[model samples]
Target: MTPIEILNKIVQAESNAREIYSEAESLREGFDNYVNKEIEEIRKQYYERADKMIAEAKERETARAEAAIQELDKKLEAELDAAKKHFEREKDAVVLKIFKLAVDADA
Candidate 1:
C-alpha cells in the first residue's frame, strides 16, 4: 500500500476509537444520573414512612393520657360520694350528743 493510504487508514481508526470512547462516556453519565434519581426517591419514601409512624405514635400516647385522666376523675368522684354518705350518717348523732352535754352543764 502507499504511505498516504496507510496514514489515512490509521487516522480513520483513531477517529473511530475516539467516537467509541465518547459514546461510552455519555452512557456512563446517563447511568449515573439514573442511579442518583433512584436513591433520592428511596430517601424520600423512607422519610415519609418515618413521619407517618411518628404521628401514629403521638396519637396513641394522647389516647392513653386521656383515658388515664378519665379514670382518675372517676376515682375522685367516688371518694367524694363516700364522704357525703359518711357525713349524712354522723350528723344527727353528733347534734344530739352536743345537746345532752349542754343540758348536763346547765344542771
Candidate 2:
C-alpha cells in the first residue's frame, strides 16, 4: 500500500474504537440508574409493611389491657357489696354492747 493510504487506515481504526468506547459507557450508566431505582422502590415497600405490623400490635395490646381493667373493676364491686351486707347484719348488736358498757362505768 502507499504510505498515505496506510496512514488513512490507521486514523479510521482509531475513530471506530473511540465510538465503541462511548457507546459502552452510555449503556453502563443506563444500567446503573435502573438498578438504583429498583432498590429504592423495594426499600419503600419494606418500610410500609413494617409500619402496618407495628400498628396492629399496638391495637391488640390496648384491647388486652382494657379487658384486664374491666375484670378488676368487677371484682372490686363484688367485695364492696359483701362488706355492706355484713355491716348491716351486725350494727344492732354492736350498739347494745356499747350502751351496757356505758351504764356499768357510771355505777
Best by lDDT: 1
lDDT by candidate, in order shown: 0.97, 0.91
In angstroms, the error of model 1 at 102 is 16
Off by over 4 Å in 1: 87-107
Q: Candidate 2 on 1-107: residue-level lDDT in tens?
A: 99999999999988989999999899999989999999999999999999999999999999999999999999989999888898799878878889889989999
TM-score of each: 0.70, 0.69
Candidate 2's displacement at residue 73, Å, is 1.9
Model 2: lowest-lDDT 10 consecutive positions: 86-95
Which pairs clash (backbone N, Cα, C closer than 3 Å) in model 1? none
How far out, in Å, is residue 92 in model 2? 4.9
In TM-score terms, candidate 2 sits at 0.69
Error of 2 at 33 (Å): 1.2
